[model samples]
Target chain A: MGLKKISDNTYEIFEEGMNVPARIFASKKILESVEKDRTIEQIKNVAKLPGILKYALALPDAHQGYGFPIGGVAAFDMDKGIISPGGVGYDINCSVRLLKTNLKKEDILKKQKEVVEELYRKIPSGVGRGSRLQITRKELNNILEGGAKYIVEKMKMGKTEDYLHMEEEGCMEDADSKKVSERAMNRGIGQLGTIGAGNHFLEVQYVDEIFDEKVAKSFGIKKGQVTIMIHCGSRGLGHQVASDYIQMMEKEYGFQNLPDRELINAPIKSRLGKDYYSAMCAAANFAFANKQIITHWVREELVRIFPKVKIDVVYDVCHNIAKFEEQIIDGKKRKICIHRKGATRAFGPGRKEIPEAYRKIGQPVIIPGSMGTASYLLVGTKKSEEISFGSTVHGAGRVASRSEALREIKGEDIKKEMNEEGIEVKAGSWKSLAEEAPEAYKDIDEVARVVDELGISKKVARLKPLVVIKG
Target chain B: MKFKFLEHTADVKFQAFGKNEEEVFENSADALKEAICDKKKIKAAEKKDITVEGGDYESLLYKFLEEIIYLLEAEDFLISKVKEIKIKNFRLKAVLSGDKASDYNFNNEVKAVTYNEMFVKKIKNEWVAQVVLDV
Candidate 1:
């Protein structure tokens, strides 16, 4: 457990077994809290994995997860390394989407409760909740392969411009539905527009503060302008994909040699690895389609309420995923498999992956806060690419368990508190609300400050929740 | 007590107790049931049979619990009771009973079952199993 303070808000641990050093990007205060869990040990173990390049890194919001720490980020040699479902997490492509609106804060304030209620009623959420729009088995396959493009072009759900602002343009070309399991397809068929529970939410927020006027303007943001934030994933489809692949990998390659059973992986060149990657891409596509349909629903509901409101996609980012991308490593450009679990890809300016309009400013990194906290809009910086492989924290990582949160706070009380703060909140159940209380997570302001100070992702604006609809 | 929740930093963890493997597996289902909704309110209106195999007790338990999750999500079935379970060698067979999920209100969602910190074994005379679920 020997960790050296390598630089300001950066720590490194290189040990005997680890093939590469484990680096953690955290302020001193954040590092203290991070060490309280198994995050350090998990990242250290990740460093020892086969073919790991650069270093196993943890963002500021690092917390203990099943295999990889929630905020863990690592890149591996494409041919020499491995692909693990655990590294990508259970909810594949569990991501965030931001929508900019022409309406102002005052426009929503007058009808905040009605707005939240309409959204909660329109969007399908909670456990076992199916979408209002159902698709055939064949249609589900199309979505799995097409992602947001299918929803827009074939289904006529959203605009083509909508997917343009998303990562991978809302589709990962590697997706192949033939590689996905029937069980996963069955689970996804009915969940296209639904937002499954456990930290997933649709929040109506407004820009409260802007740190950089130029970047904020470029991203179509202004103080007091309203916005919609959708946080969800592939739902049961992604969950099934992860479980199916994990079990498949376990059967193919015994976990006796792995550091952790959940850390089970397959060589990148293996058939199982390629199959899992394709299946994972298919699931990620499903998630993209899920959010796209939800966006359409939100637009329909909002227009019914206020005909003048104009909402457009700001940016969308996948927090949990693995991708093969070319990056400069140790003075050499190489294609590596990068797994980002509870981390955001904050590619700096001029990276081809970023959307064309915002290429000069860099990728828009949307880091959402816990329920009833301030979310931040950030821009990726060159420093992040040089030090942490172009990644940043995803959110205010959980500080307490669900049982602890439930025992300590009542959901009704949280609702009352939020109401008193002038934020309208609606949920399917009170228990889930209590489990996701802002108290259960780290201070998002501090988490944002640490990354901004580290020069990984510079803060562009801060958004305050006005209406929250939790799944 | 059949099962009780344990502390974990980010997800749901529970430990189930029984006199043998079969009982422990049943209690584990009960734990999962409670995680989703109040089992007491669920009516055994329907029944489904589940058969799964694994290489060991741990994998067997994982498969069993994962099957229940699949039933809940894919089939929209809310399991109230583990009507019966039989473990032979590395395979498991069980009968579960519950009502449609749409007919009930779920308190939480069990996203997936993880092998992380999962165990099933005998301690002295009491059979025990520990599971951490992704929520």
Candidate 2:
């Protein structure tokens, strides 16, 4: 049967195979577009998973992934639910952190090239760039155990305020370094603070418009004010862990006659599940520490270039990662594991988990757009908790494949276009740049409109890129 | 090109074809090496023997590509070619030759090899394997 429209911004499918209804949170335009893609099929597959709570929901940026859609969110019963490596993805805690700078766009317009070049040098980019700072295995383990605190509290590379603005305060207590395998550790040790390739980037932007004055002010964002956004994650370590667990889960669960092998999962209460959970947390912790170190390097680069500029991070939000939380399900408050793949946790105001500073306003949800597009800074709302499981879109999801992009768009041409638009572009190669061309992505403005209309997130400010450093 | 790199919306996908199963595996390694850097610039300065056993041909291919990825990320080894590959009952052994990544320029940082839509089957007279690597 064809999917039914729940609202102007919501649609649902109740097919025979689905254990629960699958929902899509997008406007009429996005819903129609997604129908033509593989997103709906993936969402239906997720709905058929065992013990899923409510519905399998996809955000406006939803796209077909290995198992779950990229912008997918699914909450499962703590006791009856299952945990899969595909839910968390390869790059655990792949997130974006935005820093507010005292400088204005006018101040950095002419110096964009110099600043980007310095940042390009200061922070390593591309594949195999290696770790910017060499840390012994002991220190890496401490990072895995301590999260961002290893950089801020112990190493003194950043301030406590940085940790406060991060989701989960940059430390996940469930992290057990012992659960992390030797291969994962070996892959992780030398890749910290380096931005890996394939859609990962570091962009310098400025607040182009303020939609909500109070919320923007609370976020320390002002019109024309400059900011830096780091997009990265646990890199090699997280990937290794995911690879290790996918094999383990399939072995334990017996992947006989599954819809997809990538959808292999284990019951959350199983030993394999517990081991994967701890290992995932440890890798997530590494991501937090990884971003912290990159922040340190970013700060240093800005200081070296613009000596008087002071930048403070507004918020850091992870798009990937699963978390344990309590939610009202079937009229009962039940603990559940929410797996947000290519989706962000958007806890509205008054949620106890939100930082005290943002408790009155809402949790900051940073949604970075594709290259040369307008990004958005938003906040969670009560409506989000009522509808979505406190989750929102991560970015303007890719609409075109890399091969199609290369065939249609040329890197040098797009780079020149960005330059004409007053955006400084830096990358390992121009060929890589074409694959991430702005044309390859969906209309972020349309995605923003859907979320704003759905009340899952409310827009506070919009950012336009000034300098982009692609990995 | 022994292998053609297909485009997924998000990740890097490839299909390698060979007359035999062993050549398909070798071509897959070549595709992975080309993903990292310009394979022509890479020298066969180092050689390592590798053995992998999987539940099936699909698992064997996944494990084999995963091992190649692990070597690149952990040991900084860039594979230029695979030789003397013997495949029997889902157990495969081969010798990989390449140089240290530090000695050459890097093009892409491939994170993990995934089994999503992955297959190893005979199409007509050729053996073809489709893969997707998460970067």
Candidate 3:
């Protein structure tokens, strides 16, 4: 509760239990909503964790999650720190991908209904919806290790350009399929191209506005150009991996000294910790492979509508993940484990971690808002690395609970409203739509504005949804 | 009659009650079933037995709820109800019945059970368990 306004857009809390101060980056308006929940407390608890380097941070869209607040970021010293499943979150590599198409808004408007319907039919979505592309358990292991690269090169689902545009080249090289448990493998074998329910979606959108023309051109975007965005994770595979490791960690290292049971972790150098990292990477690779397969389907479905349509990968970003990266810690560059939950890596220009094509312009950070809202495309700034360890908010954070949204909104009514607004909407169930109504989330434009104001990630373009496919 | 959902920002929260530990565990399974689908619509066409061990009562409840998720994810079994349950020395055994998940509509995807604000306790006359599910 001992929060101090450190600067124009940052707050720091240093209490008795904290080893380092917990910092929150937000405008005054966003801070008010953040204070309404336990996000502040969660971050403070994160600050108490062992070997935490710098301070625990919450972004503008920070919201209370189970152990660590959603939109949380923290770095830990590899030697003395711990790797927590709660920090990386359950949906390992829950990410977003953008595809820039040559088609214009008018081109999509001509056959919006048919396109939406075709996409809905082609892509398996919703709870318990199995993928159409089935693979053997051995093939699933290859995907777990090979990631998007395997899908692009081996499966021939996409081109070299596809994986090149993704973070980590669409695969974490350290991913070891053997580290993944049998139960996790069973859950994932049939879920490669499926989008599970609960806030996962694929939206057909068009560029509404461009603020940085040069950067927008580099990212292959223009005013009125159509772009498709896919939002999903590794599906059941990722979920099971997190559960498997969380239980394993709890059994290996009891939570007696931890602040919360969900915050249970093992030393980074421990065998158990290394195994989790490898398993986590494997799960993340599955997500990349999953999205790649879906990309192929999306292309197949859209090409039928426009034979000449050209779709290229703009970028793909994983918000829920942990990785080892070199950062300047106390005037010396050292590799530390950075955990980003409900946050995106916004690496600035010249960072070797970025794709070669965009390395000079910084990583393309894609922030997809709730359905029917305006999403933003931003480029990372140098200030982001200095302030928030090259990270930024993921989306318009949820402000209301699912039950409250269900109680107040009707799915049929929401569909009608979206239709009137010229957005084609398709979903597996009416209840799923109601639970994710735009009103249940904070205003995305405002959330983006706060980050832009802080210079963490500068906004380049805004996208308006033309069609929404929800699971 | 046994469980009711509570409010949480980004997940599902619920509390189940019973007269004893076994009854509470059964109702908790019912609570999980209700979260996935309409339990009445699910017929108990198949039955499977589950066994799990934990360090304490709280973890025992956690593992029990997680088995429901594992069944739904790995085995494609949507547990309709818990026909029998028993807990001894931090270990649990139960008989569960349900059909394939593809047979019915799922309202939401319950990703994984969490220990965040989880509890299992007995108060004066009633046994209670609290859980928060990540969806």
Q: Candidate 2, what DockQ?
A: 0.73
| Native contacts recovered by model 3 | 0.74
TM-scores of the candidates are 0.99, 0.98, 0.99
| Candidate 3 residue-wise lDDT, B1-135, digit = tens | 699999988899999999999999899888988887744578889999999999988888888998898889888898878988888998899999889888887758999899988888998899999999999
Give TM-scores of the second chain, every candidate. 0.97, 0.95, 0.95
DockQ of each: 0.83, 0.73, 0.81
Output the worst ten-in-a-row residue range by lDDT, candidate 2 chain A: A28-37
Please give the clash total of every predicted structure, in order. Answer: 0, 0, 0
Per-residue error (Å), model 2, residue B71: 1.0
Task: Give the better candidate number (2 or 3) by DockQ.
Answer: 3
**For model 1, what is the alpha-carbon lDDT of residue A25?**
88
Candidate 1, after superposition: displacement of residue A44 in Å? Answer: 1.2
Quantify all predictions' global Cα lDDT against the true fold.
0.92, 0.88, 0.92
* lDDT for each residue of candidate 2 in B1-135, tens digit (9 for 90 to 100): 599988687778999999999999999988888776744567889998999999889989999999999998899988888967999999999999888877776667788898888999999999999998886
What TM-score does model 3 achieve against the real structure? 0.99
List ranges where model 2 is wrong by over 4 Å. Answer: B38-40
Q: Write model 2 residue lDDT over A1-471, tens digit each, in one string.
A: 588988788899989878899999888778766776678888888898888999999999998788888999999987899998898899999999989999999888978879888989888888778886889989888899899977899998899999888988898989999989999999999998888888888999999999999999998888999988989999999999999999888877877756778888888888998889999999999998988999999888888878898878789898889889887776787789999999998888898888889999889999999988889999998878878988899999988887789899999999999999999999988768998998888899999988998899999999999999998
